[model samples]
Target: MSEGTGAVTNAGEGEEVLQPFSVTIGATVPTGFEHTAAEEVKEKIGAEASISKDRGRIYFEITTDNLPKVHHLKSVDNLFVVVKCYDNYQFKDTKEDALLDLQEIAPVLPWSNALEVWKLNNSVKKKRSRRRGAAPKPKPSGDDSEGEKLQAETSMSEETEEQGEVCPEQDMSLQREQNSETIENKPLKFRVTCNRAGDKHSFTSNDAARDFGGAVQEFFQWKADMTKFDVEVLLNIHNNEVVIGIALTEESLHRRNITHFGPTTLRSTLAYGMLRLSKPQISDVIVDPMCGTGAIPLEGVIEWSHSFFLSGDNHDMAVSRTVNNINHIVKRRQTGGSTSPGLPIDTVQWDLCHLPMRTSSVDIITTDMPFGKRMGSKKKNWDLYPSCLREMARVCRPSTGRAVLLTQDKKCFQKALLRMSGLWRKTHTVWVNVGGLHAGVFVLLRTGAIFGSTPENKRESQKASETQVEDMMENI
Candidate 1:
């Protein structure tokens, strides 16, 4: 192993090789939500996940090698098979040295490269044999004939080559084939995905990773007649170290296909994290008053089948989007999709500050509050947050009832919660990354007692009441 590069070299005399089947697979969760995501993995995934967190990402490991099984986890932002990690690597800082270090740490092409090397030696051996008047021995034609194997491999390769590159259908088939076959064989098809997270670099991390990728491509194609494998190699370079992994899902799981549209619709992963934080019960009556696109309620439907969900948004367009997505989500589940059968969902078009449900009815309230950027104004949020939270406290079951609110306006939300401190008790406050927005998800437990209005509240109330009476008298 190289001290500067943290690169592992082949053993000279006696060495143990890593088995391909023993690869480590893990999930990448949103920033500031590692503990929740990891808990979900342990509970839902049941893999006893090991967590490693970075600034904006969390890497989790499981015992199982089944990448597909863990790929579609709701809370996971991305899933990948950890290919290699260079611990405490000392980057030489120069582009040339970085490329060399990357190349050194990259996973070895045991099947392709070793076979190519052997083939080269045989090619020279064949020439010598021709000079000595000796021809290669024939492979017997039976179930294990070399001819059949070569033909099958050739057909598979040609189909992949004909597809040009990045063939999904071929890639899936190749993954299954590779997993089933223990024998050393070339990879089907492959690509490279590199991510660099640091500042003031000597060279672009992309160029360094790509240079390494290109070198890998060259190494596999060195002496082989044909090579086709579509493996998306992931390189996460940061903190003078490179953590390499293979992307499990072609597209991110966060991009829920069910949600076709929503300008301010919350991301599914964030919704999932909030729901998990709330610790919802199957018997709980859940609601998301500002359910712009129903991402939260939709996730609830998929996650827990028995929970009763009531979602609403005051805006007509937002309600329409939510309704359409809800219908689509149900339809997908009904048509043998992965989601479980949830009870009928109720959609409403009502204001969050004034919900239609009776007081102390709802057991849980989970909502993505307006961030004042795309949906609502920060000035308006001062009043809206307080009113919405008060209404939530009114509807919540008090004491046992909980509301998990996601918002970027942390200061305003805290103020609102503090103003109506008697109505609810703050249980937890978590900072999470939804895309790039630094947001907080506050969990509050409703305190059943409805305290009398304070002197300030009374005066404000009296002024509003007097104005209302005057308006009524004038109208009469």
Candidate 2:
């Protein structure tokens, strides 16, 4: 045992050993992202350390060949051992010394390092044998080997046949069928996530627990609620699942894939940011008047299981692309029997500045306002904000429906809010890292009541009927 380095050592007790020590590595700030990064670090450390999440943090266990160095390293609180294992028959004094050394670093670790030292010794013995004797084992001969190979082939063929029959189109039907059943029977939680660095994917719910396996299982078990059980954890699998975590759907990560696409609002942020809204108990009707790439509204519908996934945008190309994408997703889900959820977006060719829907008809108005940096020109953005927001406010039921919007230009948006006569009130702001742009996601509530010239014009029109009042109003 070593005091400063938190290293566990094996003195010349005739054989080498491997040690298992649990560690917690500290994270650099812009907080709430340490958990995901820590898990990634654990994997990078190779077979020695494994991380399982617990209580919103990760539980890291490392197996080391050099116990003394690890013990010495323990003095650094950034990474310290919480548990240690050793063989019982040997190294009693060494274990005690190691414990004392590790305690000086982090006193909270449970379990003695001596009880399981035998296993480490065994592993060392096996490694030594493999190194010392380089000769490979001879292959099995004749019918015995042939029989085993044939059996393996048969099993593989059956699996391939089953998989070959399955396609993306049947995926949605399968999800709908599974929705009717309870969540307890599932094998692993399916999570979807966008591959954004520094985004928070640490929340644990009952759904996360049943769906995720490996390190995620440990984390979710400790932090999540278990009463409401539904297990599905979707993660962005790009970059070798480096950005792997929970997502609402696969579409949540689609925005990042658009190259030379420039700046854009992510669907994950828009969906998760809208939890503050007050709404009816209705099962569906989530609308995005400006559903560019079908990000916001798709997030809303998939996350909440809202039935009517209605979306509209002024740009024909964007609308067409969105339609094709959504249609592809829908068609795949219909034929593939997938358990994954679908947003089932219905795209319409319309302008956000003049919405086609009736007043007070929407349950949610979640959108990403186009800005000069992304798709629209600066002058166009200036013209678009107020008119579009006014229309969004007009169609939404005040006090009941809420709008979640993301914008890089907060000052201009605020001016629009004020000019529209309080159609929207700023509620909350989530600073998100969408690609490289650090932007604010705003949640606003519609005031519902008519504002600006609409109410004033009505009052003037009524005033014209009264003799004395009309004369005074007209003159003024």
Candidate 3:
């Protein structure tokens, strides 16, 4: 389908499939955030039709005509793409190495020249790599203390001669020039977020790295090392327009879709947690009770092959949105006449407080609990929060399945866990900034007591022992 073997420059009217193409992605923002992100990508290359929030990930289909123009923009060392390949409907990793790769898998394009814009930052960085430390202090010649004094006198005499030749006004002008030179010599560390809406190529910098870090502290929330950043500010620049994004990561990239919801899976935050478990299964069944908006459930459904995903949410609107989401995902998979349920998702409307399922049924439960102030209604948040967790313990299989839940209120969830007779065991904690709000993820395990112990008589014995332990801990 390509026009020819050689690389094509302009995406002219050619019936060719050989040319390369890319998809530009963006993340979450206020109401009007995507215009900047989209315009930035458009300025890089020509686009056909834009798909906003198709499946949690904002997508755009671009023509191959802008291949050369876009490819010229890449400067990063190891640019890769996160996609769900043809063989699978899950988000998988791919290398954006050559034009052929982009063309062969042309259905999914890079989020408006992501690699190219990322490379532009790399080039800028390379240009700014000026080393420091006063060159090497010239080794002192073998001279006694008196010799040093004589050298100082000679330098003073030279300065006096130079000063005498210039008028007072000229002296001031020369001093100003020297100061300007000094300022120029000081390091310039400009930090600008390149992926924000409508403000892509803008940057700001102080004369030094430390000062710049201080200046952008509020912008970046830089907790640790300043290095290891790809583009300090994410640059979604394509065709010359730019968007500014700060402290950009994979999660931020997924969230940048202005017209659509973010990806169901393969996002940085959720993916990191899933990978951490390192559990082995032949397409494990992951459930998300109280699956609002179907983010985690859809992600789980797409992450692996032969995986079974069951999602439930009490909200009717959420259920409708999720249904449309699932349909869109399936249609996208069937677009090129492909058939593979790499990760199939199943959805239902079920309240977490009283899940309509049996014990030891589900494998893993990962959900972002509805936070009162930010997401859920107050009275329902208070009532549903604890009850939902107790139901999680009731339905999960003992010792075989684990629960990873994220919430801003740890004390409430902790109390819920304690009251349930130690049904869930706390595993790990991860801190995340969701929409600029702080939250912690508590990974829990459904213990034997919650799902019913092994043998009939042994089950009662285990329950008594767990009760005793809980009582002692509560008393202490």
Candidate 4:
């Protein structure tokens, strides 16, 4: 989200001392992708970074002099620098006692004009958006429905009521939460997520949480902005403990600067995670046959300097988008950026079922295949999967080469896998939560040869495979 790409910034600084500080930063990722995100954190941010994950989120504790490097980490959604972790956050505790607790934490934290505060412990889980042309899905609603609206009114009403308190520094951002159906239907301009967990002794009611939020605004001198906010703060409360930190970037890190995108452009973070799991090495010829807008190859070139990329898609529009995005990357590189030369790269527009490649020519492959309700046809995939897998097997190097494919059509994909059990071996399968869909990421190793595998031979096998697929789909 921030402009820089995780490089050392401001070496001669005030807070960064000779002895690097022990800092805790939060990294968020799509569900079940924490392992890969944690790897990115260690590789990009700190060599000795201690990482932990909860609810698909990562918390990294590292002793580092360079904080900007952490800011530039890919495969992460949001980044937070922890200011404090408290043992107790009882807003309903005695007024004097609550004030005292907030006082101790206030001075150490660097306050912003506008703050987006959230609870990590008892936070609400957001509902995912529905695929296009599918049913009109509901928005992600959290349990703290009224809590948000209450927090907003209380902040504005209370602040305005205490009309005469004169303060020298006024960096308050006025952010109010609206709970109306009209506002809810529209995309959220800004959001403050509250996570409440561990020990019910603190919040006697939802107002208790609202009051605490007001206390935070008052202590930090932050103004609530219903329209917008400059910073996001995560409050993690575990039992009697609470940890607070401000986001390192204004927007989520997953939102890259790529100017062009396809209808199904893969998430940059997911693309990075897939590459990491692909076990790419020097001289590895990696590929993404379904490469939409070049996220996979673009991320690959940036992270793996030794590898070359072959990105292709069946759609002409996808190819155009990828080319445009590559040009932008090149422009950025000229003005001094971290991405490797976008050289040793090639693009193609062809049918996935009939790829033009030599047997055992490619070293590795990774692609985000079509999924979702309307995005892909389960019936068509029955024919497409086997054909595409055969072509992919023909291209990848035998015995040692690998691929990481993501798709939500588990039944169809598994049917294809079962039919071609000898050609590819499934090494790992991880179910990742993407836009509310449980996408299975398959890591397959090229085990059998496919130089002259005839497509005609599959007609007989198709009849049997379809029967098994139907049964599997029923159980699913």
Candidate 5:
């Protein structure tokens, strides 16, 4: 393979083969899990990632041969092949000047390597689609084929007219004939998507994309398509930084796991980050007390198959959704011809304050608590948080157990933690963005104190079961 270019030379044939070229890959991860995503990239891909801190992005270099490994990553939402990156881009003071500069740079920038990678990625996507049971592309009818032939001829005529503008009639005829020989080669359809940031920018993302896209169209003679495009070119601008890339993923990787949906289903990518924070061990029994749609436990079982997962929720609908999602995955595996098509996960319906398990049985507990906006209310959280935490501590093994809980009600969670200080100790906190709501993923370790011996635990157990039942009804 060539050092910078993604080309190789065949030894026996002396032919240049386009194979494994180096490219800079960029990934968008969940906000606040940037470092966590970067660490996964390093461990899995063996490449050092440069975190774009607070921006939910990371960049790393990898050969095209290693591209498949990137798709297996759990933390990234989207992937793109970096064409160019300018850390200190100096935009002109006026919008027109800035846009003009962008247009002028279109043809001069490197495109061959990135476009090749994009072509390779298309094959990868098609293979994955087939594996997922996507229908094959329908062949064109006779009439449609004839229309496409006419369109290709018209395009050839346009190109000939432009090139032979000042030439004789015979030269124009000759150019047209030459272009007609390659009418079967269709021009690629593409769209430019611009993401612009910075208060000082004089142009909107659309304005930049329009001007830059026009220049790119003129240079490459490719069609401009907004929706049905084969290529997606990205123009990202953040203050003084600018990056140009080709998208590698059509849909976000977060949608890879779950098939069944719930009202408040968590993103599988964020669930992976939460699991990473807990650091599950071999043979560990992890449990999710409030597994809304079983996203966390499903992700855990898939990534850490050696560990067992138990998912439970108080609501009947939530439990059903979890079961359906797990069955969908098991069926998918069975279809894939696995001898033992069962996952190391099970779903149950149980109250958060009273789990159906032995004390000190679970090795880890991770859950997404109701944030009072969609599932429950702030008034109920006052009673719900403390009760659940106590029960989780009871089931979790002391000193060796850990819990990673995500909640938008930081104030309420912190208050409850203060009350249960004897059973759980806050070791780390990761602030995250969940659908525009800022939340915290609190990482707590089980203290050495036994469950019933703590004053907090005794007080929690002394609360009337009647009041707990009333609170649960109110939440429902």
Candidate 6:
């Protein structure tokens, strides 16, 4: 295939060259949202993604012209360009034999295209970094400064020790020869990161990385630098499957949105997944009653600019943090030459159980509730969930309105939903991983039953009167 329009040119040839080819791109997403991420890839990049269930990964093929679009995907946490994939790789019986096989395969894989893509991605990332006002680090000079010399020495020592079977004398001699030969022409620095999952594996991830890395160094004559590497190679092995790739993202993209963080900040990637589940439409009034830093509403306003978002929390700190995060985005937009630097979002401080919004006003409600671990207690949630859910039903438009609520207190939430069955109907549920805690995202639709006419409303009114009578008797 001929390279597309944005194909990389050979550095020696000072002209643009068209070489058409397709490469597989791998992305890591929130574990339970693999389908959500794959759907996003299909919608935005026009690529049909293959989802690896329960692994939080998806793969799709795209031409070089679409590389920049891959970086802009909101559902992916990290991106990598695949060099090669083996669906059913055979492992040798012994650890040494398996690791040796990995080392032997490094030189024969298709590295040219992936490396070219990596080079092209550097320009894209640099442009983004500059826009974010992040200054780039100066390239290390070839001159043997004391720090460089020490780092090189330390790296050699560590590699030798990690291999355990390497002859220190031979390694030092080889290093000296390699250093002398590349003194004039500096080689790219690199590191190998291996992630292996499977109980049947004979080798640890470190063993595979070290042996494979040594072979890569020998084949390319590249220097091994762990911290300041120019390139990162990934070795992902799961069961009989193996995928070798070049890392395209230096850091996880989930940090792209938030500036000011609260005690329990939800990941932006996960937030996007939750928002996608809501299926937002034009002019939808979305509300997050317990917005804690306003992550949900902020993500909603950015992705679905047609929707208006209202974020509120009872805590003073949370309200302040939400406002700060919104202002940061406004400033960024203003700097980017936006004629109107305002987002369709607003923040307030209010109790979740006593929202100030009028009944039947909101179209959608999405919020990440306190998991009772970091933010609130389990005892409090027992009381909090049912009360807030009632209030949510009051504001949500009947039949057409929906809410996506995430919480680790599933038992409490389920019980609360049972009490509000007259007002809310659970339509779907997605189990997700949040900060190592197992949580559920419940998708509930508002029942056609009017606000105060529900059986739940009558029960709440009776309970409130009973409590008021008890207080009055104590005063008398």
Q: How do the predictions measure up, each by TM-score?
A: 0.74, 0.44, 0.45, 0.68, 0.86, 0.85
**lDDT of the candidates, in the order given:** 0.61, 0.41, 0.42, 0.59, 0.77, 0.77
Model 2: residues with Cα > 4 Å off, grouped in runs: 1-281, 338-344, 451-476
How well is each residue in 165-242 modelled by candidate 1, as lDDT tens digits? 011111111232112222246443555555666674565655765666666667654222233334445567666656
RMSD of each: 14.5, 20.9, 24.0, 12.8, 11.3, 10.0
Summing lDDT over every window of 10 consecutive residues in candidate 3, give the lowest-scoring window: 160-169
Q: For model 5, how does the per-residue alpha-carbon lDDT over 1-476 read when each residue is reduced to its tens digit? A: 12258555674656444556688988878888899998999999899999862287799999877777787788887788888888888999999999999999999988888876676665555445545666333221111100001000111112100000000112111111122212137787877877666799998777888888888889989888776666777788889889888888765666566666666778878899999999999999999999977889999998999999999998988898789788877977887788988898988898887788999999999998999887789999998998888889999999999999999999999999999999999999999888778899999999999888867566666664567688899999
**For residues 1-476, could you state the per-residue lDDT of candidate 2 as single tens digits?**
21122243564764333234433221111112233334344444432332322111232334433322221221011122222222121211343442233223222323233212222322333343444444332221111100000000110012100000000111111121222122233333322111112223332222122233323345333223222212322221111112122211111122221211212434332233332232324464677776655645544454456457688878776676566656655544555465763554578989675678887888677666665665677677765687677667767877666777766667778777776655677776656444344556677776656533476434433443364466678899
Query: Model 2 misses residue 103 by how many Å?
Result: 21
- The reply for model 1, stretches above 4 Å from the true place, is 1-21, 60-68, 107-189, 222-229, 337-342, 451-476
**Candidate 3 structure quality by residue, lDDT tens digits, 1-476:** 11122233543574332234343323332122233334434554444223233211223443333322322211110111222212112211332222223223323323233433333323332232321112222231122111001000110012100000000111111111122212124432333222112222122111112232333433434332333333343223232322222222212222110112322221222432332342426666677776655656655555444567788887776676567666766755565255772346778997676678886787778776766764565556655665676667667777777787777676677676666546777776656444444666677767777444435325544655686689799999
- In model 3, the number of clashes is 48
Which one wins by lDDT: 2 or 5?
5
Q: Identify the superior model by lDDT, candidate 1 or candidate 5.
A: 5
**What order do candidates take by TM-score, descending?**
5, 6, 1, 4, 3, 2
Instruction: Encode model 6's per-residue lDDT on 1-476: one tens digit a residue.
Output: 12223344664656445454688888877778889999999998899999852277799999876776787788887788898888889999999899889989999988888886776566554445545566333231121010000001122323311110000111111111122223236688988877677899997777888888899999999889887777878788889989888888766666566677766778777888999999999999999888877778888888899999999999988898889888978987888688978999999999787788899999999998887877789999998898888889989999999999999899999999998899999999999877667789999999998987857688885775687689799999
In angstroms, what RMSD does candidate 2 have relative to the true structure? 20.9
Which residue pairs of candidate 1 clash?
188-228, 188-229, 189-229, 189-230, 189-231, 190-229, 190-230, 190-231, 191-231, 372-376
The residue-level lDDT of candidate 3 at 418 comes to 64
Model 3 sits at a Cα RMSD from the real structure of 24.0
RMSD of 1: 14.5
Of candidate 5, the 10-residue stretch with the lowest lDDT total is 160-169
Residue 235's C-alpha lDDT in candidate 1? 64
